[model samples]
Target chain A: MDFVNLGRTGLKVSRICLGCMSYGDPNRGMHSWTLDEAASRPFIQRALELGINFFDTANMYSLGSSEEIVGRAIRDFTKRDEIVIATKVFFPLNPNDPNSGGLSRKAILREIDASLKRLGTDYVDLYQIHRLDPNTPIEETLEALHDVVKAGKARYLGASSMHAWQFTRRSIWRTCMAGRGLSACSRITT
Target chain B: MLPLCAAEGVGVIPWSPLARGRLARPWQSATTTRTENDQFGKGLYGATEEADRRIVDRVSEIAQSRGVPMAQVALAWMLSKRPITAPIIGATKPQHLDDAVKALDVKLTAEEIEKLEEFYVPHAIAGFK
Candidate 1:
């Protein structure tokens, strides 16, 4: 497998990242066609054998079971430091709970811990927002993510499945913040 | 997304380069797990199925002449784009994985690439919903 640095970061990842959306208990999640642990293990093992060290999953995938399966599979087959694991947040985990979704400070802080616990890891290589949350202020989301990086919970921040203009707005905001001489992931009380 | 990502040096990883099996199979009988499960995909590609078939037909023609699977030719066409870092292929079987890896070797000419793209009309963005 070919290796490439993710974004501008020094994190080297395999060109082929094994997406774990399909690995989890089919009975426990939104997707009816997901694979159980028994069926998912071989695919994870095969991907590792093929020299793919990068794996991506999300907290909401299979209702958190995907993270569990992926974590167990990686631990069983490879060393912790040898692979790059990416998981996403921002989706609602509980429909009854108002605090369960979006990129708000409360949600990001809560979800990262929940994800790390499920993944059986102290830190994730990358933590991403699963989608854009229009309800939450972008600054709050960024600051919360910055806190995650500062606390050593995640090595990098990423966003997924958003419009180009949305991404551009976030990117521009980040640049402006940087230009103001703010440190990476500094605490913002907003 | 491709050009903007290229300009920013952000690696572009494309999902569903085969349009969730739409490009791999004949348009009339097209149906996959995604088409069945994902209403978003149905709305995205299903409406353009007739127009997109022109591109898929070209891909099928190339694949038949070169003795490669249709999926490989389609994947090769995606790989031919410079800004793409990797095409994230969803493989259920080992053979699916093998075919995807082989797509790296199926080279297409400039003319073939142009012919394949000639019929593609823009549609509403999918995948971000």
Candidate 2:
């Protein structure tokens, strides 16, 4: 597989990133057609054999069973340093809890720890906001993400699926913050 | 979007580059296991299947002439576009991955690309929501 630099980061990821959205238990509430852990292992192993070192998943995928399956497969097949793990946050893990979702500082702090534990890793290479959280202030979200980086839970930050203007504003805010010698968002995408 | 990504040096990773197997075998939507199981793909491509069929037919023609799988042709077309760093392929079978890896070699001519694109009609974007 071909390797390319992921944006401006020092990380070199395989061009063909294995998306783990399909790797979860079907019994989970997310979707009816997901592959179970046993069914998912061969696909992950094949991807590794094909030289794919990048994998993407989300905390809410199959209620976080996707992360668990991916983590177990990666640990069994490859070394920790040999791969780049990317997972997303910003969605409600528990619908009953009002504070369980969004880009709020409290949610970010709570979710990252849960994701890290599920992935069986000390840190993730890229921690992304799964969607735009209109309820939370952008600055507050960035500050929380910066704290994630500072606390060594994640190395970089990413955003996904927002209006162009909102994304531009977020990108500009991050750049300005970085210029002023503060933590900033690393990428705006999707 | 391609131009902006290029100027910013951002790598574009195209998910569902095969359109969830629609481009590979457009007619297979009626019976394909993936299409049956993929509610997202059904809503996204199945709604516009008629419009996209013409594009799929052209891809099939090109693949026939080149002696390659339709998935390879579709993937090669995406790779030919500007600012695409990678096309994330959903390979359920080992052969699917093999087809994707070989797509890097199936370069389409200008005429072939124009033929494949001429019949495409835009519809609502899916899979993001």
Candidate 3:
């Protein structure tokens, strides 16, 4: 698969990112971006045929069930290292469980471990903050993310669906901004 | 422009880069007229007969002169813009992709671009943020 740097990070992903919002379940009402497990194989097979190696998924997407499916599908089917998997953290898995979500230091640390277990991977290529946490200090989020990178749990970090605008609409400038979040996903695009 | 985008390293994937099957014949939507915002809106064809006819004619002329699909002319214009990393083309069916790929190699000159732009210049396009 052809690789391109994702944003400013040294980490590179396929130019064609397969979006997996279509891969996990049927209740397409709450977070409609998903595909059921049964339909995931051919979808993945086709993507591989097209040289698509990067995928995107988030915890908020089907509340983490999507992550499990992506992790299991890839591990059980394709060669692990050839394809890159990314999933996100943020939205609550259980709305009633307040401590379960957000970007607080505690939330990020705990969620990263949970995401690691769910993803069934020792280290993520790009660990992203699914969304910025207003409740937690940016320093804490950055440090937590930095710590993960230092510990080797996550290889690098990236962000998505961000509202933060880059001044140069033309240049692919790579800056280590202080305020931002990261998310991960594994694509099975049709 | 492609050089500019390349210089800036801005990756661009133009959505509806070909105006949703409007560039090709056996034109998919048959209502002839659709809500401007509906996926198959005739806004591309022209708001009025005179206007739409002009749009089609401009595309048709360039398409014929270039000896390629009109959609190719459009994609070529974009690829001409170069630094475009990719185009997020929507494919309702397989032919949609087949049709879009046609424009990959058609490079439009500066004059042709200006002419095509003029054809639809009068349309009161709406809703941009």
Candidate 4:
């Protein structure tokens, strides 16, 4: 019910973001526990009724069904501009194609469009790296993400579950390049 | 990580704040379809179960004393952290959302916060590279 600025951005997001990883086609993804679309809709509706306007999902969650289901639910339950939708990239969706994942310029560019298509939105509120790509250089990833923001594909950027040094390195790179830094960072604090 | 994010003014949105439902219940008290089958979730806490169990037990103790659900206690603890902007809460059940929202109201005392946090030993980085 409470809204706060997302990092230093003027974009206000709900203090409780409804994570959409639990909603997808149960038969499609590795997460057998995922609720099917029929089961998932009520929770999304409830979250909206409870004033939760921020929703987080990933391009890989339920192999893209999560994004589809969430996209529909948001369209049915609320206005697109009223919600802060965050999703991540990385993790190969196609086992046959190594280009399907990571933070390379190719991967980032390709995945952003794929994610937008799946979510049925022209732009996402926040686009994030699901994890640091050891395979790709940080500058390539950062520049590609800067391009994403410049293209108006995403309003802000984020990274999840990376080392502090990796984050610091990316921050320094952003400063040097005079590019956009991350607006948010997600970590697993159990 | 929290300190650095705070200094840089980057919002910290923690995922799995309840540790994939581990912190929302008594230690090893129940198993959901997710807990039993989520390989990713299993990888996260398997190595540090002993330390995590102690933290879960403390969460349970505080929840009972406060007459609230264990999920609220765990979320209240997360909400107490200064740099945390929002916790990404995964809800399969409707009550999960209610519990997360109510956590905003369940403020913990400094002593309770200390008790909840004291058992956390350093964990090997599990979720990402």
Candidate 5:
């Protein structure tokens, strides 16, 4: 696989990233089509064999089973430091708890630790917000993510599936904050 | 979004570059277990299906002409864009991953790229907030 720098960061990632949303327990989450752990391991191993070093998963994927499966497979298939593992927050693991999701400082702080535990890793290569939280101020989310990087829980910060203007707003806010801008941003252009 | 990301040097890892597998096959040719149950994927398209179908048709034509899986054509089109760092590919089968990796080598000519993108209409922002 061809490796390239992830944006301006020195971190090199493969051109093809294995999305782990499909490698979860089907019975555990809303996606009934997800592969079980046994069926998923060979694919992860195959990806490693193909030289794909980047893997992306979300906390809400299979209600966290995706991360567990990805974590275990990565551990068995390759060295932790040799690959880039990315996970996201924002979706609530429990719908009953108001603070269980979003980009609020409290939610982010709690979710990061939970994700780390599920992934069986101390620090994720990249931590992302699954979506833009309309309720939270941009500054609050950016600051909390900055703190996540500061705390060494994640090497980089990212955001996914937001409007371009919203992303520009966040980027401008980060520019003002200086050294707090996101290193990556994901979008779905259907 | 691509321009802004290019200017800011933020890596753009787009999700669903295959449009939830819509671009990877003939227009509405078949539905998988995911398509049958993916409510989220359902919400992502349909608003512009009339227009999107033309694009899918073009992808099919190109794939057929090149003797490759439709996925390689779809992913090759995405990889041609300068701002894209990597397109996150979800694979349930082994060949799915193999097809994605092979897409890097399936270079689209300038004319082919234009043909693939010519039918794109601005979709109502789907996927997330």
Candidate 6:
């Protein structure tokens, strides 16, 4: 498994990332479905053995079961520095709570802590916006993410499910580029 | 998948070119794995439906005669199209993976490729709705 550098970040990950959305899947959603730990462990181990160091999960995956399994996998078997962990913030971990999810700084900072707790790590390799929130100003969102990195809670900030055309229209990520010590996700999907 | 990704620069990972084990028949996997249903439990592989069974038979004939797994032929055709980075190959057992990988080396002739497409045009089936 040849490792590909994720753009200019100097961080390299295998082309095949372990998408553990199946782990701890609870309810069957529209596009995403679920998978239990028993059915999922083989694939995760196989992916690692096959040289996949990138793991994609979210608070939404089986309502954080995916993160739990992934965190457990890394803690129980692999070293911390050997892999890059990416997770998203923007979905309601608690369906009943209106303020549990989104890109607002309060929400972003709060959810970052929660996601860290679920992932069982102090910092996430890449903390993504998950999806664009029209309600949260990009400045507020990026600044909050930068604060997390400054506090040593995260190394980088990134996003997923953003359409390419949407990325082209925004310059806020450019403001993110000018800062030191924080790199955003590459605009590529795998 | 490739076309979608290329237009978006999104990476392509195609899955189940074999119609979820339907391409090669006498499958060992339960129909549940082929297309797990909602609470209803009705699925593509459960009842030996007509259109699907015909597809299984036709693809099998092409693969057997050409000395390839039907899965490989189907996937190779997809890979042959542009922009796919990888296909999510699933396997219940070792042989399933073998069948998928074999298609990579098969290299269908232009004529054979056309014939396969003519036979199976990727029609939409029920239950997707």
Report the lDDT tens digits of candidate 5 across residue range B1-129. Answer: 888888999998988888888988898889899889999899988688899999899999999999999999999888888778999999888799999999999999999999988988788888774
lDDT of 2 by residue, A87-112 (tens): 89988979999999899999999999
Candidate 6, residues B1-129: lDDT per residue as tens digits? 223345434333333345455565634435543255433223533554565555566566677887766777766666565554444454444354455545556677787667665544343332222
Model 3, B18-85: lDDT tens per residue? 55456554234333221233432343334545655566677878888877766667666655654443
Residue-level error in angstroms, candidate 6, position A174 = 2.3
RMSD of 5: 1.3
Q: Per-residue CA lDDT of candidate 2, range B39-75, in tens? A: 7667766678777888889988999999899999998
| lDDT, residue A140, model 1 | 89
lDDT of 6: 0.61
Candidate 1 vs candidate 6, TM-score winner: 1
Put down candidate 3 lDDT per residue, A60-169, tens digits, no spaces: 66666667767787787677687777666666677787887877777777888887787788866666655556677666767776777777777756543333232221
For residues A1-190, could you state the per-residue lDDT of candidate 5 as single tens digits? 8988888888899999999999899998789989999999999999999999999999999999999999999888899999899999999999999999999999999999999999999999999999989999988988899899899999988889888888888788777878656878888543
CA lDDT, every prediction? Answer: 0.75, 0.76, 0.55, 0.91, 0.90, 0.61
| Residue lDDT tens for model 1, B1-129 | 545555555555555667777777665575556567855556657677778888888888888888888888888887777556566666555666667667777889998888888997777665555
Candidate 2 scores an fnat of: 0.22
Worst 10 residues of 1 chain B by lDDT: B1-10
As a TM-score, model 1 comes out at 0.88
State how far residue A3 of model 3 sits from its true place (Å).
Answer: 3.1
DockQ of 4: 0.73
Better of 5 and 6 by lDDT: 5
DockQ of each: 0.33, 0.36, 0.11, 0.73, 0.73, 0.10
lDDT tens digits, residues A1-190, model 1? 6677765567787666667877889887677767789988888888888878878888998899999999998889999889888888988989999999888999999999999999999999878877879898888888888888889999877666666666666667657766211111100111
TM-score, per-candidate, Cα-based: 0.88, 0.89, 0.59, 0.97, 0.97, 0.64
**Judged by lDDT against the true structure, how good is candidate 4?**
0.91
TM-score of chain B of each: 0.88, 0.91, 0.60, 0.97, 0.97, 0.67
Find the candidate with the highest lDDT and give its number.
4
